[model samples]
Target: MADRDKDSSAESRRILDRIAREADSSGSSLVSRTVKRARDHVSAADVDEKDWVDHLGTRIGRVLGLVICVGLLAWLVMFLVRGA
Candidate 1:
């Protein structure tokens, strides 16, 4: 049991070491650090507010048009079925 525990611990340590080295080599750690710094330094006012309004308006118009078209098609179909 003791030998098994020792081997498991050593294997865990080696796996962790490999992961750490791979992260460092791939520059993921640097990217994460840079993202943290950017988030910390970012101000709400730095973002564009107009883009939000424009995006919302565009989405609303698309949804409204879809609803209108669907309602009109349903009405037309119902009217034709009743006539037949």
Candidate 2:
């Protein structure tokens, strides 16, 4: 074989060996993947239906209270201004 053919054959074998090793693995040997999984788990919400309902109820209650407070303040201002 020629010198160029020999060099190309060696490079082909090196690349094939690398591909075989990567194909045989579980593909999760990277620390970045593990860290990403941990970060996703930490930031994930574990809320149930009841928790969602409770949160919604709390928000609605606050909005209702704000409306009531503003209404009462308006009424008080009117009462003082009208002197009645």
Clashing pairs in 1: none
Residue 11's lDDT within candidate 1 is 100
- Candidate 2 Cα deviation (angstroms), residue 65: 0.4
TM match of model 2 to true structure: 0.40
Q: Give the per-residue lDDT digits (tens) of candidate 2, residues 13-60.
A: 999999887666577666767788655444332324467776566556
lDDT of 1 at 9: 100
**CA-only RMSD, every prediction:** 15.9, 19.7
User: Which candidate number would show the highest lDDT if scored against the true structure?
Assistant: 1
TM-scores of the candidates are 0.40, 0.40
- Candidate 1: lDDT over CA atoms? 0.73
Q: TM-score for model 1?
A: 0.40
Q: Could you tell me how far off, in angstroms, the CA of residue 69 lies in candidate 1 after the best superposition?
A: 0.4
Off by over 4 Å in 2: 1-50
